[model samples]
Target: MTLKNFKVLGILLLLLAVFAVGGKKVSAAVEDRDVQYTIGVVVYNQNSPEMNMFMNYYREYIQQGFPVKFYFSGSINSAEDEINFIRAMKLQGVSGIISFYGQDIQKIVEACDEEEMYYVLGSGSISDEDYDKVKTSPYFLGSVGPDAKADYEAGYNMADYFADADTSSYIVLTGGSSAGNYMHLQRTIGVLEGLAEKEGLTYSEDVEKLASSEKTTVVDAGKDNVSITICPGYMTDPKGINNLKHAFVDRNYDAVLCTFNVDEIMKTITSKEEEQGSNIKVGAVDCFSMENHDEINDNDSFGNPKIDYIAGKYASMGGPAFAILYNAMSGHPEANTDDADSNTVRLYQGFWSASDKDTFNELYGYTQDIYENAYSCADLMKVIKAYSTDTTPDDLKALTEAYTVEDVQKRIEEN
Candidate 1:
């Protein structure tokens, strides 16, 4: 009687174990283990606050479900290095990538095509030529950044504001080695054009032609009743900085127009002011740093500090990048492309000067907060969930439905 009972119990236990294992297998099947996708972010450097923020946002959103890893080149200085790094990263086990450097974009695109992976540019707009090349490729998503020409125009607006005040003859300090040269030149052209329309202004016809030439050169784009001294300051070169500072003193320029790192520019301006007492007005594109405020020598052409007049930046960039990435990954196929020309990305157009602590803090606060939260993987996923179905550039705009610079600004204002 005891043996029979033991045998029956064993059989029942075996059957129960079998059922449990089968149930586990069924659950695993639903979860889809075979599809372990990953995103590889190829950035120039991890140390820069901007890069850190971009990666953080990507990682934050990706960690929720998608596997994301970072592949960064220490501090790439040339196009070749960037290309190699991207090529190597493509070989890694990643389904997609978001590349940051501009110099090696073509190479990166080619590599991505070879690897059969999806990609997008995180910052810096692409050229029409590049756009034409990737127009039909599924592997090439699109770029998420301000139009370089537009940024230049915004910067030129600062210059125009200064020129209107009769403060002519300026020096321009543009950022990003060769890549940055084009935008800075474009803004310079805009400044020249704006100046030409004003009374007593003279412009050089060579300005447009010079700006467009392969060799980066300085030229007056238009004739104005005023004289504008143009000096080219390379953003990354210390020699270029010193030369620009010297040009400011030598020419007694009315203003200093900068389109790159505000901190570095401030240092150049401060050194000149302290050493030579040059009263050059400082005008620029994008937000100014705290250091710039402490060191500003004069009110901008607009009566506010030049840095304070940054229009539609914080939300324009961070907000859209998050929106686009989300749409792309979540399945809105077209979220990455900016074909609409509607500034769906929030751009802040305001300025800060040393005289107004409130204004300075307000703009800085907004920009910083965006850097902190906007491009995260979660927000990105939200956009993707809504827009991932888009299969064309026209469809991408639909994914930007949830956010606006004003939305981001509102959050900043409330906080």
Candidate 2:
């Protein structure tokens, strides 16, 4: 070939290379970079399956192959202790926080605001008053988890499972239904309302106050000699452990309807169920994991799965929550908060109900604790405004609502 022809070929290749690099630069997203964004995970308990799966999902979602890191705090109670923890996180170069703490959300936000950092609630929600106050703040990125309506339905459905049992005795293992816990309050009320409607009984007592009573109380069966013992407190502390044992020993109820994930707690008394030869049906709001899977598969003396009804969420549901906080820190503070008045991201995530072992096994595909949940790092990146500009808060809501066991199964099959 001639020298002129060879030179022309070289020039053509150089132009193509320039165009390729330019194309890459134009599509740059923050997720492509090696950025470090430290997030704080505020938890009530470090050992519970719910909390463990929750943090596991957040870690796999936000920490894997992204410019993000998570700094978890030990059990935080009052706002004062949490505020102090936030101060400590700031010194570690933490950029933002995702809190599962339920108490004094306003105070937690206030502390974040003071630190000049971004904040997001991993689960549960802020009060209407609290949302109105902090919704406009650039630092406050809104909240998620079941609201009062959802909580009520979750509890109602749990009790409704045993509606036709015709059992005269029932023991309710209420978790945190004590005063100041709105989630448990709504759940307890729903349980009572549902049990009454289906059990052919009438209740005139102030059951609503049972939510905020902060103590265990006996709900009047009202008719047919039914004794509904409302047992509050979990299976952890001494008082709570004693309460659990006493409820089983004293009430000898035929069924247990719990508002929280009581799979482990219930396992504590399987021997008692055997000794009494009780065919107790169990329902709880729990998580989608093998530990729970095993419990759902376990049978009592009557060959019934320890737990038959579960109103639960997948571990990966917490991913979008981190995405919201990351967006705020990315300067797209208005990415969510579709409402003009609230200016806060208010989204609802419903539960995945597994009424039987077959349903749970079909819904939850994992056989072990190495839970590679449905939402992968790539899926989580979709809601990240920095990565996907067109992604809206509405998208997060829809994703959360639709992330069912079937959804997980479909994702696994497709991949």
Candidate 3:
């Protein structure tokens, strides 16, 4: 060959070698990531901002450099569909799943068993029967979220604070049987338990336990003891606010307890006030909006009188979910992964009260923060890395067990 041709040939060979090396490096990185494992997320609906924030954080911090994929079963409506979705994820060779179903968990457990895929429950607690059945599955990781019991504790704590010094009757408002979702039931139960624990309080078991009464002793013997009674109005619909208003107006109650949605509850109370000039003390759970805060502050709807009031709706689920899902994907099996009832399930700090704006800010400041900037995605990623590969059930348990109430409190405080 001529000298010029040989030189051209040599340059072309050099370029080919460089391209070959670069391709191998890229392939190696992809292999290292193991992105082949898809993670299925089954939420009641995909439209909630909270869910979006979580998934965004997961993508940015946990999956950016990783090879994990996410398959979301948006707006799961029925048990059979839920089971089918789990099976579909298994078909996709998903490494695991993170879910929060509105209905039952048995379908989820049974589906996981058939697929042999690792799973973690969030948002919903399992029934006793299902808990027993799924507690031994290696594929079932521990759950983490704000549970029903915590919600009830918060509700009762608010009631105690508002009624502690007053000797007057109060008004209570409920969303009726429709609001008897497991979470609401837990919160209501907690309130009842808290009231029962306090001295001088008795609930009429027959009247749906909506209200209670007690007589307070005055220091002056000449003065009579004041009889405080609580009367509750049940709202099955928004128009039921009229019924609630009538119940409060006709009855001799002092304060109002709203064990339902903050926005709707606030609207009903305000509407009633405008209609009948009522000033009932109100207490509710999960009132996070600024408008809700202003209404509580400006109005007498027995505003959150204590620190842990109105249990911060869904904001408490973010940190624990990041930690748990990471643990599952990293292959570190949690001991309680199999036992849904174990304390290993992380309980994140919720905005327990709305008595003060600053207090509210302390527990949850996300209302003002950007999705990505609000929390540490990298820290979440580290936890996932620990659990992604070569994970054992004991390892999973240890990690979950490490997340105690004290730890969560500290984390909440630090953040």
Candidate 4:
């Protein structure tokens, strides 16, 4: 009896040891498998200041903690280019993609679904038709971008700033004309509306009316003493820039309103000021870098700051997009249950306007500090985890609504 009992006990102990070791090996294999996936980022322009700032925060605060690697496609200018970029990224074996360019949303979403890759929009909105078509795709994770109404409000506010400064005559720079440049068009329309309201001026023709015409430039607004010239084209258009310079030289307008390429136009204005000794005020929309901040705060010969107002995108646009893509890839997708289709579209409002130096300094200073200290890779992962299945679309919206410097600082502090 004693010998048999001892043999049974010895056999049981050996089996338990074998199972324990095998379980550990299986766990190790799963963890190793998690590290094999990759994410591809599609950016319109690699050299853009805003995109550069976004990538810096992405690498520091999001990419580091993730087990996946990152790949960046070259600049995409059109819808066809974006589709081609997605196909290439699929070929490279990316598990998911975050695209900054949102043109041809339906086609892009279809391509991602066909390739079995998760897709998230980094910025920009899709049309209603496109939304209806692709919103239910399992591969379409969703999108985050500047809200259209908020963008229009920013444009209105800036135009109001110029009018309050008593700007009577000005030239407006509208960036791009294609569907991809929809944001620019919204801002341009808002600027015209604001000017017409505050100055009692009226546009003979609107952007839509003028867009179809052969006229690229229009004297669209006029009152007894107030007038505005609108120029619609690409920011990097040499011909357009030259035409703007010629108009400025001839008329010596009171101000210049730029919807994009603020830095380039600022340089042009400074050159004109140096040559003709004219002090022209500027109101622009772009990311606020240290260099731009210095320019905004600098005084001309008459002791007046050259830049009156600036509306900027936050530095960490990539953070929320990464969270969306990561969540979908990790098998917990954020869905919009309120919509009839029960599909998700994560819209983030990201327009911060500062008219005074103190406001700009506070906003910029806190943002820099967060990037350097408070929000790390681990912190970003925690935020992404907050988007678990139990979380609602409102919850996801709250996470991305932290658009201001103060909002971001509070989130970091809470983390």
Best by TM-score: 2
Better of 2 and 3 by TM-score: 2
Model 2 scores a C-alpha lDDT of 0.70
Instruction: Evaluate model 1: give its lDDT.
Output: 0.50
Candidate 4: tens digits of C-alpha lDDT, residues 1-415:
4674455455434433533654411122124466656777777776676665665555444555567666565667887767665665565566888888877788888877777888888766676677788888888877777867866777788889999997887788777633346677778777878887888876776645543222346465656588677766665677667767766666667788888758767677887777767677888877666656787678877677768788867656566677777766775564332455544666766677788777876666644554442234543455454434456556556767666666666766766
For model 1, residues 1-415, the per-residue Cα lDDT tens digits are 4673455455434433543654411122113344344455556655454555455444433343443343334455676655554444444444566666756466766766666766766666777786776656656666666666566566557656766665655555544323445656666666555655653455445655433343323445354434455555554566566657556556455566665545456556655555654455665554333344343434533354534333323322444443454455555553445544321222222222222445655544544443333233333444454524434444334433323445545543444
Question: Scored by CA lDDT, what does every candidate get?
Answer: 0.50, 0.70, 0.50, 0.67
RMSD of 4: 13.1
Whichever of 1 and 2 has more lDDT, that candidate is: 2
Error of 4 at 217 (Å): 4.0
- Order by TM-score, highest first: 2, 4, 1, 3
Alpha carbon deviation, residue 69, candidate 4 (Å): 2.9
Which regions of candidate 2 deviate over 4 angstroms?
1-35, 210-216, 338-343, 366-374, 403-415
TM-score of 2: 0.83
C-alpha lDDT (0 to 100) for residue 264 of candidate 1: 55
Kindly report which residue stretches of model 1 are placed more than 4 angstroms away from their true locations once superposed: 1-38, 45-71, 90-92, 164-166, 174-180, 209-227, 287-312, 322-357, 370-381, 386-415
Model 3 ranges with Cα > 4 A deviation:
1-38, 45-74, 84-95, 146-149, 165-169, 173-182, 193-199, 206-254, 278-280, 287-309, 313-316, 334-351, 366-375, 378-382, 385-415
Query: What's the distance in Å from true for residue 80, model 3?
Result: 3.0
TM-score of candidate 1 on Cα atoms, chains taken together:
0.66
Which scores better on TM-score, 3 or 4? 4
